[model samples]
Target: MANAQLKEEIIAYSKRIGIDKIGFAAADPFVSFKNRLLEQQQLGFESGFEKGSIEERTNPSTLLPEAKTIISIALAYPSKLKNAPKSKKGDRRGIFCRASWGEDYHHILRRKLQALEEFILTKVEDAKCLSMVDTGELSDRAVAERAGIGWSGKNCAIITPEFGSYVYLGEMITTISIPPDTPIEDQCGTCNKCVEACPTGALVQGGQLDSNKCIAFLTQTKDMLGERYRKKIGNRLYGCDTCQVVCPENKGKDFHHHPEMEPDPDIVKPQLIPLLTISNKEFKRKFGRISGSWRGKKPIQRNAIIALAHYKEKEALPTLFHLLESDPRPVIRGTAAWAIGEFTEKSCEEKLIQAKNREKDPNVLYEIDKALKNKEFDKIQG
Candidate 1:
């Protein structure tokens, strides 16, 4: 009964500290989750981005030996960007996903968890606590699910009743046992909207995801995007929101609870051409605060070139030609070759041929050859 009172105090204090939602969970091993993860690994569905081994991921005891409860918190982010900029003809712009819109959630959630840890220390002097954000071994989604923060939507997002699936989740494991909240009932029902709406079909069979096919994951890749996914990636610069955006539960669900979570229209939807030429210092100065810049500028630049091709911006041809001839990175040179080939320019074939002759790297040469083929096909169609 004393633990129950502590739970109430924690929940109340959490709200006072700007935590949008909080829930308690018993520090038990996620037995079924471990098996499911193993299955995902066996079926090659795992994204290389996961942080820990299966055992460490599913076992809370490994984090804190005397762990008795896990406290999960969620902070909602806005789905709709207010006064979003237009992506017009000569000034086409690429997009960073909604999750990357604001100041990085990792920092925000970490600070909140730290505050909660300090509060808990005051209540129970002997309590041992460990907290982590997305980078931590424990799965944020799994912890949120068990703690009843929200149901796991078909898109693999934790869908809270008040906030939809746009919430950032964090957790703290503690030796002090708190009463666990009942898990929210799965409400996805028979609707497969997210699966059907996914452009790359990354959401395989509802909640399970094949991250390789996920455009969100592909956008963060430093290597050239797979040829098959290039056209489908569209104008996405950082991540894909097709699954979440199409969720019926998320319809008309927009929140601006945290000021820091708000997006700057021009930054998130910046003109694509300037992105290709941004200096490292300039990129840091402008995008340094957002979550999208974590992977550095190379991938974003590559995707921007692909976005230009997707838009078929004829005005960008001159700049693309410059990148094809001079970019130091092979991925950039190769992607530029691919985008140039995608264009209907008559000189594209000749330019690709010249690049192929000068390019010593086999991969870049292959890209050039592929572009030349595209040029021939484009000419035939014309």
Candidate 2:
């Protein structure tokens, strides 16, 4: 069986199995990508969630011995929520990014890759294959770009012609040789919308990111969010979509090919206040399946507190006070204290002072002190 014929069979089979797009590339060291990653590391721009060392990430052969061809797959997810719920005055809602709207994409893309791996195995019994999704050692965007699946967008996403930048990417490194597809020409010529619109200026420039300043990365951390980014976070409970939302290439590019990728409006954009007191079991039952929940309920809850602060939803003050006084997690308590301070209520001073007295955690104490002395409140009242 010729490799070209097998590649054709694989493509046909991929369509049957719901892979939106597929492309092939020669497995080679990503020299340019390695240099960029080294720069990212030197500048402390990595998100810490990255899984592998530069050598392991840039060289596909290191992952799989004798790797010859790489197969990259893209699955398009819905960008627009159908019949989305509204975030009203007292019942404001926090949102998960489009990437986390539905079921976890890692599972969805991995399943597709597994099916492709099985199909490849059947064709060539001696063929060796290794598959991975977003968390893999190799960069999904780099592989997808090399495979002609998409051009690497300035937003650091693989922008496919068919689905724009709203596609989930995965890849398989194979021992068998296959004719590779032509790499897509860079189509994001002179358009700087994504970089310009990054809320935290996380996009340092086109095609470069400072992960420390990225809202998407900050929202997933377990500790207290920087005071500067709290208001910038807005109502995002998990992840950030500012760059993607602002991309010209992604204009009106919503796709809903897979039913599993469709978002539940309520789950993806739930009311913010209830999230403050949600139990771990309830959080798991409601959001456990989604990728945004990977860091667990702490970050989401912390972000929800910040969201309430952003809205200045005075109705949330009671809940915020309760969390400040009683929440076991320091991140939650500290964030809640900050949210309470946003109200600038004279009544909150005693509560903040009391919390300050009891708070053992230095971070929580600082937040309480900031809340107590809320200079904006004093300046306005004076």
Candidate lDDT values, in order: 0.91, 0.91
10 residues in a row with least lDDT, candidate 1: 373-382
In candidate 2, list every pair of residues with a backbone clash: none
Query: Any runs in candidate 2 off by more than 4 Å, and if so which?
Result: 379-381
lDDT of 1: 0.91
Candidate 1 regions exceeding 4 Å error are: 375-382
- On residues 60-135, what C-alpha lDDT tens digit does candidate 2 reach at each position? 9999999999999999999999899999898999999999978899999989999899989999999999999989
lDDT of 1 by residue, 142-226 (tens): 9999999999998989999988898899999999988899999999999999999989878888889998899999999999899
lDDT accuracy of residue 116 in candidate 2 = 91
